[model samples]
Each structure stands twice: as C-alpha cells, then as structure tokens.
Target: AASLLGAPIGHDLCIISLSDLMTPWERIEKRIRAAAIGDFVTAVYNPKSEGRYWQLYRLKELFLEERSPGTPVGYVRQAGREEQVVNLTTLAEFDPEQVDMFTVILIGNSQSYEAGGKFITPRGYYGEIKMKTDVGIGQDIMIRSFRTIEKELKDKEMPLDKKWALLHAIHTTADFDMENILRIDDHAVASLYEKFNRGEVRTIITDVTMAASGIRKGALQRMGIEVKCYLQDERTIQLATEKGITRTQAGIRLAVQEHPGALYAFGNAPTALIELCDLIRKGKATPAGIIAAPVGFVHVQESKHMVKPFVSIPKLIIEGRKGGSNLAATLVNAILCYNDAEQLKPGRDV
Candidate 1:
C-alpha cells in the first residue's frame, strides 16, 4: 500500500529485499542513503527472519539519523492474521529487533499526529473532538419529537439522499411554566445560547416573560439555528424581535413550515390555548390529540356557545388536580410511546 501510494511523478522509490534471498547488502546501503536524504514515510516489510536479523537495525539507523526523533513509526506483525499486533510509537522508541518476515513498519512524517488521530486517517482529513453535551431528555412528550430524530441518527441506515434530510429535521423542546413561569433572564439566555451553539438544542420552548427579547433571537441566528417561541405574550413578542429570537408564534406557528407536525404538547395559558384553537380551525395545526390533564385546575372555561363545539371544556376545581404535573407527564409518555390518541383523554387538553 505504501509503495502504491508513493508511485507518482519523478519521485524514485527504492525497495530493498531485506531477506537473504536476492538483493545484495551494498545495493541496499546505496538505496537506504538515497531514501534517507529524500524524506518519505517508508514502509518496511520482511525486515527480520529466523535466519537473518541485523538488517533491521541498519535500516532503522539510516531512517532515524535523517528523520526527527519524535516521528511516528508503526509496526504491524502478522498483517491480517488472528495474532496480529500493531504498535505505534516514535522512531526513538521503536525496537527494530522485534520485527520479522511477517512484520511491516511504517515511518510517518512529523505533522502526522498533529493532523489528527490515527483512526480518522482512513478518511481524507483530520478529526476533531470538541466537548459535547448528550441531550438526556426522557421518553416524555418533549422527548417524542426527538425520538424520531434519535432513531434516524442511530440507524445511519438511510440512503445518502435521506441522510441529510433527517439531520436537518428540527430537534426541539417546549417548556410551559407549569409550576412557576420560568423566565428567560439574561443568565438563562446566555446558558441557552451556549447549549444551542453546541448543537445540544435546536427549538426552544419558552413563554415570553422568562427573558428579554433581542439577545436570544440575535444570538440564535448568529449560531445558525432556528428558535421557535411557544405561547408568547405581546410584550414577549416585542422582546423576542429585539432579542433577535427566531420567533415562531405559539406551537402552531411551526405548522406554517413546509412539513407540518402537531405541537409537542397541548397545555398553556388561555390566550395561547385560543391561539391553538384558531390554528386548528384554520386547518394549519391539528389537535396534538392528547389531553394533558383532564380533571385538573383549568384557568379557562369554554364559553357556552363554544362548549357545544369543543369537547375539552368542563368545570374547574378550586385547586389543580393532585400530582397534575406527574399525570401530564405520564399522559404525554403514553401518547408518544403508544401512538394512541386516547391518551389525550381521561385528562385535560391544553
């Protein structure tokens, strides 16, 4: 493989038969001197045998004297056999006597290690290992959207045409202030920006009040990603524009895209709820078809006229359902996992 790689143009290559068979020592010395001066990543095969041994040292010395001490040298014994041993070390640390007729040695150039790890050398370029965060979202509603994405990544079974399509699909998250409305303060925005830059997140699900507007929008655009804002207030919309956030109004806003999908969840403030209904009425968004908490504290009640049109409305208790959060989470899990629309029932929708 080395000789085949080097056989181009006017560069002369010399191969010495280190085995005690055909080539003479005087001729080998001449070739070695020429090779030492030329500076190449030489491959040595059949450097040792049970009968003859000293030639390996001579070859090593010839290369070592000319090349830098820290140059990478690889030794492979028994090539593809079961007992194969491949060791990579510097020229200064190589032990030539260990080689035999079945062994191969590769002497690399100085910049070899700096270029990348050896494993990636099989490819055309260097490799990189940037610090990354593995998203650990559970198999909840927020995670179902990502489930398809994760499968596509793990399969790597797609054809070349479909590969990039899967990669470009949105892997997102939606957050509703269930307990306390999580605000997007500057600190939170900064943290989110870092995560977005690292490809740890794509779609951000947050309400308008959690943050100032212009920074998140501008920063996300600068990072070359899409940021969809769910359940935004009028003030948050202004702030989102100023923050340069990639604003997609409410979950249904994403339906305007070329590929329309259901919102990850169905519960938010009444204003957001009505916006979702409007989208559904317009045929722009489908009911996620899952009720989040059916018998819980609903802030909004369907009007008498709308109640005839909607099946989701009911009387609200003074306090929210016990473990409303857990029930919502469980329902989302069921919907996402079983692909059962029935999961939306037994509880409240939005």
Candidate 2:
C-alpha cells in the first residue's frame, strides 16, 4: 500500500486495529493515547461495525486532545475492490458513522493540506516544482495566459527574457502587433531582474498617481520597497510653476534628485519621460531602469524616441504612443513576477 500510494505512508506512523473483541478496550485506548501524544500519522483498520461504534468516536476524542481540528483525514472503503469509496476530510468534520469494518481511515499530522481533491502531507519539499504545480485561480490564469502567448510566438526567435517581456506586452494590450513596437535592450530584461532581486532598485518613481496606485503595494512591501509619485507634492508644484514646466517633469526631476538609481515608470506625461531622458544624457541621474509608456498624441513618440540614445541602462518602452498607466503597471508587475529567482529556472515553462 505504501508503494502504491507513492511513499506517503513511509513517514513515521502506527497502525492499530480498532476491533476491541480480542484486544481489551483499555489497551486500545492506551495505544490511541500513545499515537496521539507521539504526533504520529495513524491508520485505523476495522474502525467500526454494528456493535463497535463508540471506539471511533473515542479515537477522535483522544486525537483531538493533541491535534488541530483542521488535521486532514482520509478514508478508503473496499480498497482495490469494485465498490470502492475514497474521501478526504478534516478531523473537525470526521464522521464516525461513515466508517465500518471494511473501511480504513488515515489521519494526517500537522503538515497535510488538501490539494487537487487529495490530502497531501508536505514532506519538507514546500518549494519544489511538485508543490507549485497546483496554484490558485490568479496564478492559474497567469500561467495559462503565458502558455497561450508562448503558443502564439512559437515561430519567433528571441531569448527567454525578451520573449517574456514581449508576451507580457501582448498580454497587457491584447494586440499581437505589440511584439513589433515593444523595445527592450538585449540584457535589459535580465538586468532588471537582477537589480530587483539584489535590492539595488529600492524605490519606484512614477509620473502619475494612477501609475503609482496601480503598482502592487503588497508585492513591493514584501520586497521591502516603496513606490513614489511626487506630482502632487507642494514643492513640485512650486518648482514647476516657477520653472514654467509641467508638474510631472518637475516631479521626475525632483524624484531623480531625491532617489538616485530608482526605477522610473512614466505612464502619462511625455514631459516626464523627456525629463528622464535629459537627466540620463546630462549624467545628473542614474536610474536603475525605466518603464516609458506615456500615452499621448503630442510628444509621446518623440519622448520615447529621445530615450533611445541612452543604451547603457535597462529600459522597457512601448512605442508608437499607445500606452497608459495600466500598461506601465502591468509591465512593472511582469518584471516583478519574473524577478522570482526560483520561478526563473533554466527550463521553467514560464
């Protein structure tokens, strides 16, 4: 049975027959108490019958004293037979009436979880691929979307990082033509992941409040980072008014001054992108990376084109003036997701 179940039963466990006809009830109780106190995953055979019913309830009571109510419980009746019934439940929901002489009950320790309709006791490989295969709805959607994007780009020849960026651009815009307009340096995508993982990029400066708000705050908090948008700052407003420049441009200049080597994400104002490009050209600011996706008819294309000359730093640009805060935020999140070192293994599907 252990071999058939793929070694789930190989862990420290004790099996006891609940038939009290030959074994005295006192001795059975002692064995149950020992199993419960020792924290052993237990299997009970012949759990109940017509006359022997209260023993299963007694076993539950004894186990409850030591185990949590959420401990997993699995039941199998008529194993290997035609009329077999297998169930996965919890200790709090265990029904003694469901068991009989033909049933085998396997109760789990503190580490088990219900996954894909089965009880899984994690055997210390929580970060392995086997444990990650079953994900929740949000992750499942992202994986499926990536798969679809991969299938659509099967004929294209590009590196995995670039492909990942392109796929995310397409995913954000729902436009297959985005692959043509997306601009990413050869090593920029990889450098972005490295900077993010190494904590080199600690602050994310955005042009607009929408872009700043769209970034996942929880994800940034987990990485010990902060997002900033200085467009509404009083100093920025005063500086912009005094210099006769847009508030976003002044904010970008101020942000670069305050947080050097910060990630710059521009989604709204082309002036902000233009200011960032000017800062880079003048050596006044050294940004970790730039996400330039300003949506406008005026100078959006021109501003993005301006940033093209500076090739020393990482940049993710959505060309042709077809971008907004949502697209910019999506691109940032895509980079964040890719920064997960464990998920970016050599042969990983995503």
Candidate 2: segments with Cα more than 4 A from true spot: 1-133, 339-350
Model 1 spans > 4 angstroms off: 1-16, 114-350
lDDT (Cα, tens digit) per residue for candidate 2, span 269-325: 999999988888888899888898999899999999998877787898999979899
lDDT for each of the candidates?
0.40, 0.77
Candidate 1, residues 1-350, lDDT tens digits: the string is: 33222211222334455775676788877777676666554666677777668887887787766664545667778766788876666666789867778887776532222112231011121224321212222323322343234232433222322222122112212222222211111222233323444655444322232221311343345445443444354654564477564343433354333223322222333334344455556767443232222222443344112212434322111113322322323322222222112111111121
Q: Give the lDDT of residue 342 in candidate 1.
A: 12
Error of 2 at 31 (Å): 60
How far does residue 224 in candidate 2 sit from its true spot (Å)? 1.2
Worst 10 residues of 2 by lDDT: 341-350
TM per candidate = 0.31, 0.59
Root-mean-square deviation of Cα positions for candidate 1 versus the true structure, in angstroms: 20.9
lDDT of 1: 0.40
